[model samples]
Target chain A: MAIEVRIPTILRSYTGGAKVVEGSGDTLNDLLTDLDSRHAGLRGRLVTEAGALHRFVNVYVNDEDVRFLGALDAKLSDGDSVTILPAVAGGAFGFAAAAAIAQHNTAAGRRTPVTVG
Target chain B: MLSIDRSIVDAIVAHARRDHPDEACGVVAGPVGSDQPTRHIPMDNAARSMTFYEFDSMEQLRVWREMDDRDEEPIVIYHSHTATEAYPSRTDVSFAGEPGAHYLLVSTREPDTEEIRSFRIVDGVVTEEPVRILDAGVDPHAVQSYMFGQSPATVDYECSGR
Candidate 1:
């Protein structure tokens, strides 16, 4: 029931600089809990206070983004591999504009428009 | 200080110009632990906005995996400011998550001139750094001429909103 988790460089400090760590659980949430027990504060960086995945932290279960697979509830099995990557995002806009855009997108009930490249 | 190749700079500027009025974003990967930037990868700006840029999630995943397989890391994370100076905006600082990689900004506000600058944003603090462009035939490892100072070639312009 061992699942391998690949850590991004920015969060490696929590894992004693280990690029890959092993944990076990039936779901992504459980696995993160297991790892957090040893890593300390790592889970806080990936999950928000409301228990949802952080908007800027991307978690992929194997090849699929966990967002499309039930997020924290995403199922996991033995030997599953999870990769955590910090979202590479930004802009030249001011904070007020960003907040306005965010509100507009949320009100429209749509995620930021994305075009696959 | 960020020391990069002239060809790579040209490529980034070209990408920025081609995507004029829209933000362009990309990464330059180098060998693990090597600060030198060698591979230039132009990423799609998913947001595709005049003032914002975000990498396509799937493309980012694939590119990151390829960098991992090649034992490389993102030495430089770059983006263009279509209507502003080559500086990190509040949104840029809030979203900067990479502490080890240089955050490069290219300003295409002026049609005739391109302004480029680099910064290190750690813990929400942005610090500008010098850029040295290595000419072709020059050793990438050897020291080169410093092209820009902290402010770079940015022209004075009035920002409507803070």
Candidate 2:
């Protein structure tokens, strides 16, 4: 059976304004190759030279992460839905200190002492 | 009808603010339908740009197991935005791992000024919903009153180190 891949707005231009596309495949790798063939610049976004799924690209098979399963080679069955979620990370400020303090307070033996000033 | 204890939202916001500049991620767990706070699965993600968040695989898996052990599914997957609009970006929309998951984004860019928004992202569609605000009342961490076990989330590494 064929699966439907929905394209995000940012990448729609590459798909010629077609957000949702149909293709037939039994695995993520095959589906992705077909998608890249039909649309340019798509493959480069997913895999790197080592043939590993670029860490930036996250794929989900029927809402379950393929990364947790088998990455690109993750198997897909007929009618099974697959989602491609490339890790999108871009922003101005970094949330480092706040995360650290929160963790410290939560860690074993590291209590956040109450302070009054 | 979807009631989330205001305290969980506040604590998540505060935590995000504390990590201003980089991205902060966490998991919100409840009874799938409850008024009281459930659990918070704190995690780390490497910041790439102004509007994208990539979580650590090990951390995410660990939290997933933790949530499973508690017999609760992750109801909300949260992250922070440092410079972009609270609205989900094309990138965020493209890779919505959860079709029925509540996607919450807290903009810590306006550090002193807090702006937090919650969204329901499904199949590339992002819908903004009203998040019932809870009064901070007596405790600064008051919202965290019903917090589950503290999993101790720490940033193993960051690019900017901010």
Candidate 3:
């Protein structure tokens, strides 16, 4: 199973100037876990501790957003392409609302008058 | 991932271009079930001429939610272009939150030669979706409304909890 994953602009430094990388795996988690083992801080950057994907970083499997799907557990194909999109900060008020929503949603409690964008 | 009517797009652009050198805003109403989409939602920008956009307030959200309860999910977001076209700017791309909604932009340079465009932005990339102006049918009254401070209804979310 061979696949190509595109690196987002924010995390390019971790991959040492390589915008694209190659990996092989039957499952999305296996591939991402392998990528993290090879690239120091990638996994931590992409997934949260409870296994939910970060909104700041969008991972697309063959142009399909993982957020709308099964996230990291989403299956992959041999020739599928993975695109990593990072939240850009050049624009003012970048991802603060989405990040806040994500942080608040995962806190494990009732609505609590949770603030959302 | 969604499609909306052109007439609604025109209404959104109309309200936005009226703000001319300032910012305008509105909410989009649609069928209440999941995936319901809107062409545009009218809004009032607190920043005014500053042209900055922040979140909507609780009271405002409450009003829209009430309307939404009567209707469907508020699926589209409309904003103005103070000095430019109906295109996405760097700031617009960054502050995008409702990935599930459509973005409508109206250029204010020449209301007569109005422009409208829809977009879906994720992360930092802005993807333009096709949108056309409809029976907006030449309204001198709307033109006059634009000059006055009569902006579309707005919900102030930035100062909601703070």
Candidate 4:
């Protein structure tokens, strides 16, 4: 049984719209590396140049958070399910409101929110 | 569509209302193994955008660390829609990483009332669920005391013979 990796909507394009894919490895790092080999550029989105999980990215094994389990070094097993998600803070507040805030913040000389791809 | 305490629902609504046109975001932390959404942690929307909301990275780190110390998990991850219905947007769906969490949405578009909804976002699929609002049943004062880390027994006995 291979590890099942679940991809989030934002990252789906890299997976060819695959919601779930299988990879084999003894650890999360190995699994992600294996996945990147098949799906180019996927690792770049999830990991930083320093080989660490992206600040805005989260990975979970089964139902336990990887951060609590050793992050990328967390061990993996066949049949384990992995999920990836971007670290976003809020939701659904209309685009108009966001635009207004962005404009206001820019005018007020505040740090504008990072625009996620 | 998991069952949640009325207080928890109220807190989320109150937060959304308080933030008004700007987006509000937060999480309900529950006992790690139990998955009960009990503790309310209202977060500051760093984006502070009327149309967008994002957690302040520093605040998120602090709150998440506190949850870990308390052996709690974010069972209900929630945010608000100010000018729209209580539904997850495509952006929201894209960020729904917590598969085990109940993604609760509260809309404060109306001045008179709020519209609240819940969904399970798993594998990029949004599944709306029925929210069973639970009556806490416990004495309000006792619950308050307990939340403040005070002994519930003291509050219960001080108020009445139990």
Top candidate when judged by DockQ against the true structure:
1
**Candidate 2 chain B least-lDDT 10 residues:** B153-162
Worst 10 residues of 4 chain A by lDDT: A88-97
The local lDDT score (0 to 100) that residue B162 gets in candidate 2 is: 17
Residue A107 of candidate 2: its Cα lDDT?
A: 75
**Candidate 3 off by > 4 Å:** A1-117, B1-3, B33-41, B132-162
- Regions of model 1 farther than 4 Å from truth: A94-96, A99-117, B137-162
Clashing pairs in 4: A89-B55, A90-B53, A97-B51, A98-B51
- Report lDDT (Cα) of residue A4, candidate 2: 79
Q: List-wise, what DockQ does each model earn?
A: 0.43, 0.12, 0.05, 0.25
Backbone clash count, each prediction separately: 0, 19, 15, 4
TM-score of chain B of each: 0.85, 0.74, 0.67, 0.83
Candidate 2 lDDT by residue in tens digits, B57-118: 54554555455566666667788877765666665665565544577777665545556666
lDDT (10s digit) by residue, model 1, range B40-140? 88889877778878888888899999999999899999999999889898889877888999999999888877888889999899988888787773344
Pairing residues by index, what is the TM-score of model 4?
Answer: 0.61
**Cα lDDT of model 3 by residue, B52-116, tens digit:** 54433332444444654565555667676655656777667755655656666665655355555
lDDT for predicted candidate 3 compared with the true structure: 0.57
CA displacement after TM-score superposition, residue B10 of candidate 3 (Å):
3.7
In model 1, residue pairs whose N, Cα or C atoms come closer than 3 Å (at least 3 residues apart or on different chains), thus clashing, are: none
Every model's TM-score: 0.85, 0.52, 0.45, 0.61
Model 3, span A20-74: residue lDDT tens = 8988777678888888888988888787888777645667777566755687788
Regions of candidate 2 where Cα sits further than 4 Å from its true position: A1-117, B32-37, B48-50, B135-162
